[model samples]
Target: MSLGDEHDGQTRTRLPEGNTGDPYATPRRPARGSRSLIAVVGVVALLIAAIALANRGSDTPTGGSDTTGGAGAPARSAAPTAASGVRPVTGKNGEIPTGYARDEQGAQSAATNYAVALGSVDMFQRGPREAIVRAIHDPAVTDGLVKRLDDSYSAAFLANVGLTPEGLAPSGLTFVSRTIPVGAKVKDFTNDTATVEVWCTGLVGLAGEGSTKPVTSTWFTITEKLRWTGGDWKITGSEQTEGPTPVNGDNRASMADDIAKAVEGYGGFTYAR
Candidate 1:
């Protein structure tokens, strides 16, 4: 899916009104004007000095005298880094990854990984799609979502995207559908539930000789409301919206064979934090 565009707005500043009686002011007023100018300059100088001092502290090396214990910068606390040191899940429920932790970081990791699973090429196939839905979604919603998605990816929809009724690409081509999460955040979270938003960039289409549906990239955000169940985070619901996209770069597009080769060569990551 693709996102809509955003427009930038301009800002204008108005200057303060001039003193009306300035033209006929007394000669002594010139001294007052000088005093005022000096005051303003002093304020500016003070501001510059303060900024320089602040930046100097920031620029100091970790090994400097200011560091605690003079060993280096203070060790980063776990609160900010959130390093549990727990290994990520190495198992998969069918094609979808499984076994997420039960914290805010766990919720974020689950959401990002689920987004990748749901956006994959396998989601077009009946068996794999059902497995994925059952794997990622909460048990309460799995059946409903599976039925809805089955109806949504109908035969006509498959044909429109140049896929067979069985959801397979033609023999000569390889279908490409993969989501790469750029980042994720928890919008609302508690011990039992969380709302997570994942920003992702994806590639979708067919890669092959004379391919009309050439691979293309898109940006979007997926918001998943998750529930902690079965000792893991499972999505209760999800909605996608257009992205905070950037302007396209000047890089030249690659050939279909190269695209196919690259997809095969580079594997995707299991995201965290």
Candidate 2:
């Protein structure tokens, strides 16, 4: 079964007050002249100039770099939605991504993709499940982790989830368990270790006519503590928790056949952060 189904400021600079007469002279009846007005206008102009400068800085093209504290310089902290520009890794260990860059972005990318692999339908099976565990987990824990996962996908557990002892769905049904990561964030990072949280939505169940377990969607977050091992990011530990779920929509649910067909027709993605 998919893990998703189970687990789940600002400083202000003071502007100069307009040059008023000396404090003693200020006691003279407020000047009727435009000195006060001029000061006000000057202040307004300065504010407008400051605002314009800020706007220009915000509008600078992201591709340009300004090393001299110019408008074109990138912000010290990137906007949350800004892309990392890291491409998806080209290497695959049995369809799981490998060879992640040794950086925070790479850690996030590995955590996201590893979550997908661990929550996959293949995890309900034996051979593919073992392969997945070995590929994504750190070498120090691979053997023990594989054994633990094997026990978790026991024959009775498979049967409970509407799968056969061998992890197959009944003749007419398609078993679906897929996790799609919505986004990833780094919780902590260092040169050799990183902790990432992957928010994901998944579907897990049997899809077909008269299937006892109709495919349903779930939302959850998977937190993976990863270590840089053997020149790549590998999961050292992981946890899942229930979602930041959205309110259910009013759209009608699709039929079993349609859901089954869609599952077969659509392909899952390889995620990057």
Among the numbered candidates, top lDDT falls to 2
lDDT of model 2, residue 224: 81
Question: Which ten contiguous residues of candidate 1 have the minimum total lDDT?
Answer: 19-28
Name model 2 segments beyond 4 Å from true: 1-85
lDDT of 1 by residue, 51-168 (tens): 1212222223011123345565585322322333344454656545567666666677788778777766677789977887788878988786777667756786576566788888
What are the RMSD figures for all models against the true structure?
Answer: 24.5, 25.7
**lDDT at residue 191 of model 1 (Cα atoms):** 78
The C-alpha TM-scores of every prediction are 0.69, 0.71
Considering only N, C-alpha and C atoms within 3 Å, which residue pairs clash in candidate 1?
none
lDDT of 2 by residue, 1-273 (tens): 111111111111112122110000001112234222111110111111111212222223122232557777755543343544445464777667687777666777788777767666676678987787788878888887666656655676566556789988889998776666777777888889988887777666678999766666756677788999988889777655557778889989999999899878776666666
